[model samples]
Target chain A: MYKKSRARYFFLMPGVVWILAFTFFPLIFSLYLSFTNANMRNFTQATWNLVGFQNYASIGSDLRVGETVVTSLYLTVGSTLLTLTLGTFLAWLFNHDLPGLRIFRSILTMPLFAAPIALGFMGLILFNETSGSINSIIRGLGGTGVRWMTDSWSARTAVLLLDTWQWSPFVFVIILAAMQSIPEELYEAARLDTGSGWAVFRSITFPLIAPALGTVALLRLVETFKILDIPFSMLGGGPGSATQTYSYYVYITGLRNFNMGYASALAYILVIIAIIISTVYFWRVRARFE
Target chain B: MATLKKEAVMQPVRAVQIGRSPLARILLWVAVLMAVIWVLYPFVWAVITSFKTQREALEPTIVPFLQFQPSAENWSAELGLGARETTLALGNSIAISIGATVLATVLGTLTGYALARFRYGIGNRNIVSWVLSQRFLPPVATLIPFFLVLQRLQMIDTVPGLILVNTTFTLPFAILIMRDFFADFPDEIEEAALVDGANPLQIFLRVALPLATPAITAAAIICFAFAWNEYLFASVIAPKDAKPYTFLVASTSTVRGVHFGYLATRMLIAITLPVVLSLFVQRYIVRGLSLGAVKG
Candidate 1:
């Protein structure tokens, strides 16, 4: 029995080592590095100056840091709500006994599989200020074309729109599955009661799929907060940092600016936010399970 | 009073039973058409644009049609099939993605099986949460660390390095999905195999794994798509040699001059592998989503 247990531990050792070396170790090291002024130029023979809480304190005073956080939050929250609501509606629509429903579902899901960077470039072409497909459509409709990536609010909206266009199908697929799992007997019971469609959904469907919906929302929130490639490729966080997400900020700080310590500090802040959000989500899931 | 109430409800019931009114039928068809168009227009536009000539694509035409003369010049240029550098990058992407998918699936299956069958205290839950938390950590947060590690290991700018990183990103989700799948599986089959003098390994390989083929396929496809489509890490780690087709497509920006034709061609090529893979595994994909969502 002891030998067998030892063999089982050996079977587990590789995965455990990989996770510890790559995931957890980096996480802890990053947290430590965040306190020091460790730039890439000094990387070879690095001297750590421990500035207690200075990096955290600097986050508030630094305008760009504040803006990055605000932008990331805005994108995360806005995209999650829009995608969930629209995706749920579209899923419900697709779930209806309509002709060519499979084709519609497949087409809607195409963007989900397309690379984010590709989608960003496509968005650029589609939403260009001039000589673009979308602008041309608007012009044909006798309306002036809006500067999508130039204006601050418009740029943010563009990011949100691109994210929604790409990821809503993911939410749709998940939610559609949830909706489909709903027992037919429950619906029949509601129908026998002569209940309205809204009443039936409220009484039967919503309560059952709430956990699935919550999980999807949580996943989207986490993923959206970490988004980098699309915005980086699309507007380069653009017309003066209008769409610089926290992840983008980290990239620019660490890579472009070579401020590793500051970037690490910013990253730690993101980690905290991620942890809080994930903890709440898991807690809610557990609560639901219990 | 009861008779009056019954009659009041009967009128609406009678109206509904009549059904298939011309107005309702027309409205339904119209709604369905709009929904279909909304879903398909982007892809149709992409395909149409890919075939258009450079000048034709630039023209502000509201009614762009796919009837124009088609050319494969852009495809040849973007893919660089005749050139060594571009072809090598493409090959690297395909190899690394496949390698990572296989690695992640195998490791995830083992870990998932352990968690599903074992009765470890708090450890299983911890592992589950740890996997979930991996998804939450911003990919960028780990970029520097990964770069540093890869550099130290002399694995930078290599296929194996990229595979390792991609596996880390993909393994968590695979484990989560597979664990759920294995949990839902009947234990009696495995027990019977055990009773036949099969060890745990044999029970897994001979009994449990066969039953989990559909879920495993789904996991593989998802992992492959992720490894294939990942951009930031590929960009940072393998800027030159190991950059995938995604990076290739992004690199085709119209900064100096708009190469709409070439851009469209590259985008189409980049999306081809994933589209084909997804279509092949569409059934398994649906089963996976349904299993994960509904069961949870």
Candidate 2:
């Protein structure tokens, strides 16, 4: 028995070692680095000395300090709400009987599979001149063209469009599965109670899928917060850094500008925000799923 | 009251299918069409643009062959790099993703089996939760640490380094899914195997692995897709070497000049493999994602 147990214990060794060396230790080390002045500007010093909150203090003074936070939050909130709402609606649309629904559903998963960086390439073309496909459609219809990529608001919308396009199918598919798993008897019971579509959905469908939607929303919220590749690739955080996200800023600070200390501080800040949001979610919403 | 309510509920369905009016059904079809278009428009556009000549690509015509003559200049230029860098990048993505998936699956299946079967105390729940929540460690927070660590080990610009990093990213999710898979797997078969005098390792290899094929496929696809599409780490760590397709696609920015045709060609190449694989395994995906807090 003891030898068998030891052999079972060996199963976990590789994953544990990989996680520790790559994730856990690095997390701790970065947390430590957040307190120091170990940036490019100060690496010339003989040895790095901990500055103790100075790095945090200078966060407000950083280039990505104020508007970047707002922009990041705006992007996260917008995309999360957009993805959940649109995904739920689509899921609802397909939940009922429809011919060729399987094929449509599978095709919908296409964007979910397309690389976000590749989607960035598509957006580069789609949001190209106002004469691009979208604007071309508008002009062909005798309407004025909008600046899809150059203007700040339009570029922001373009980013949202790009994200929602790629990911909403993910939420849709999950919600639809959750919807299907809902017992047919419940809908039967609710239908006999009232013919009101709104009431039936509100009472029967919504409550049951709430947990799944909650799970999906939590995932999307965190992911939206980590948005980088598309914004970086599509616009390069351009139109004057209007689209730069917190993660983008962290990369710019740490790797681009070589401001390792400041970037570590920024990363910790983002992690704190993540922790707070997740804590709130687990405290409030997670129990409903259970 | 029940009969009345049934009739009332039937109104929407009847109205939706009123063949005489056709309005509601048309609306439904229109909505479905819009959804289909919303998802597929970009790919269609990319495909069309990839086939267009430079003048046509820039001029932006909707009709492909009708408006301008088609050309393969962009595809040939991008794919026909002196050393075939795009092809190399595609191969790199495949190799790295395969490495990450294989490592993640093996370790994950083993750990998942242990978590599912072995009865441990004190640190079990904590360990499981720690492993599960590791998925939430945003790449931003871990990027530099990984880079510095990899650079120190002189593994920064290699496929093995990517596999090492991506396994960390992919392992937590794979373990969670496989744990769920194993937990939900029928224990009676394993018990019968045990009665047949098969040991744990043999039971796992012979009994468990085959039974979890669908789940293992989902896990494999998830890991492969992740490692294939991963960008930031690739950008920072393997800037010039071990450049995966994602990095290569991002590198072709209009920063020089917007070659829509050229960029679209690269985009199609970068996206085709994973997209096609994902389409086949999408059923498992729906299952894997709904259970695993969703895979990206």
Best by lDDT: 2
Residue A91 C-alpha lDDT in model 2: 86
Candidate 2: lDDT of B296? 19
Error of 2 at A274 (Å): 2.3
Per-residue lDDT of candidate 2, residues A180-218 (tens digit): 777778877877898776787799889988978888888
lDDT at position B137, candidate 1:
84
Proportion of true contacts reproduced by candidate 1: 0.34
Q: For model 1 chain A, give the 10-residue run with minimal summed lDDT.
A: A1-10
lDDT of 1: 0.72
Name the lDDT value of residue A252 in candidate 2. 91
lDDT of 1 by residue, B200-291 (tens): 77777888788788778878998898888888888777877777777766677744355666666666777667766776554345434332
Q: After superposition, how far is residue B156 of candidate 2 from its true place, in Å?
A: 1.9
lDDT of 2 by residue, B12-112 (tens): 22111122447756877789999999888899888889988767887867775688778878777876756377778878888889999999988888887
Name model 1 segments beyond 4 Å from true.
A1-13, A42-49, A99-103, A192-196, A286-290, B1-26, B62-68, B254-256, B280-296
